[model samples]
Target: MTRLPKPKALLNKQWLVGLLFVPFMAMALPADRQQPIQIDSDTADIDNKKGVSVYRGDVVMTQGTTRITGDVITIYTRDRELTRVIAQGNKARAYYEELQPGEQGIVQAWGNTIRYDVDSDQIELIKNAQLSQKGDTFTGEKIDYNLTLQTVNAKGTPSQGDNGRVQMVIQPRQEKAASTK
Candidate 1:
């Protein structure tokens, strides 16, 4: 009879031991909202602290309207709530949740290799990043937005923050224009 190697025998080397922990490391990472996510990548790194989560790699994560594809995705936690999120990559996109008018409240989204600081509730998008909501949109080299203040500040690039900023309102487009264009 043939027998597979014992579990202990497989993990004698330090490198092997470290390698063995990779899955547990990935599994131990805390993310209440990312379980149904699917990623396509060669490798990954996950860090979680005080409810905030960070994912790094050639990452492609998809969950319903939220799709974050980037080299890194950092999720911020506030009071144990998912207050802010950031994704950084070659390019990132998120179908940020929105609330219809008269429906009480709506959730907003920030997309493209982005960074979100939960304590400050700030969202930053980098490198070909774009933020859009309904018909409102902003595209630049990098974008910094404050969710609490309901304001947006964008720079042409990370280095040049003084060039100027654009302000906008997000709304649903007209039925005619949306279909044709």
Candidate 2:
């Protein structure tokens, strides 16, 4: 039998996790770059000459802690290096998630369509975009996230109804008390 961590320890862990969702400042796990990309789907069509690959029907692609799921996913490569990834959802929204460095939790995003640019390290979520980390969340019609710079730009279209409005929820941080001598 194993004993669980003390309540104080658990509280401290929660406190640390609170900052994991800080808007536009978390870094993705560096080791993920070294991992091989794995893709699974019901059907896949690869064209080496065009450097493009298309996967359909419950597609899932993963590299280390990074994962993407959608109904269709298209990958574009140049010189054998990934250049872009585009995911489109049919019945469900496209989903993406990646682990942050250190003790920070995973960052997740959902949208009708998602485009990722490898060279620029940027991700663009389109149509009912929603991003979340830890307990905090950002929702809008579109969201542009830069992983390298840790920045986010979101936009909303009023014509799309309630989801067209941009919304963000950030949790408050608990500061440690100063030690009295």
State every prediction's TM-score relative to the real structure.
0.45, 0.82
| Reference-based TM-score, model 1 | 0.45
Give the per-residue lDDT digits (tens) of candidate 1, residues 1-181.
Answer: 5544436564244223223222211111224245465556556454455665666666655544345566776665555556666666544353233233342233344555566564675667765545554445566566666655555555554245433223334353345645555
Q: What do the candidate models score in CA lDDT, each in turn?
A: 0.49, 0.84
Best by TM-score: 2
> After TM-score superposition, what is the CA distance of residue 107 in candidate 1 from its true location, in Å?
7.3
Deviation of model 2 at 67, angstroms: 0.1
Q: Which pairs clash in the backbone of model 1?
A: 87-113, 87-114, 88-113, 92-112, 99-106
**Candidate 2 Cα misplacement greater than 4 A, ranges:** 1-25, 160-163, 175-181
Q: Please provide, for model 2 over 1-181, each residue's C-alpha lDDT reduced to its tens digit, 9 standing for 90 to 100.
A: 5644348686455434433545435768888878899999999999999999999999999989999999999999989888899999999999999998775688999999999998899999999799888677878889888888777777778666555656777777657899999
User: How many angstroms is residue 180 displaced in model 2 relative to the true structure, after the best TM-score fit?
Assistant: 13
In angstroms, the error of model 2 at 78 is 1.5
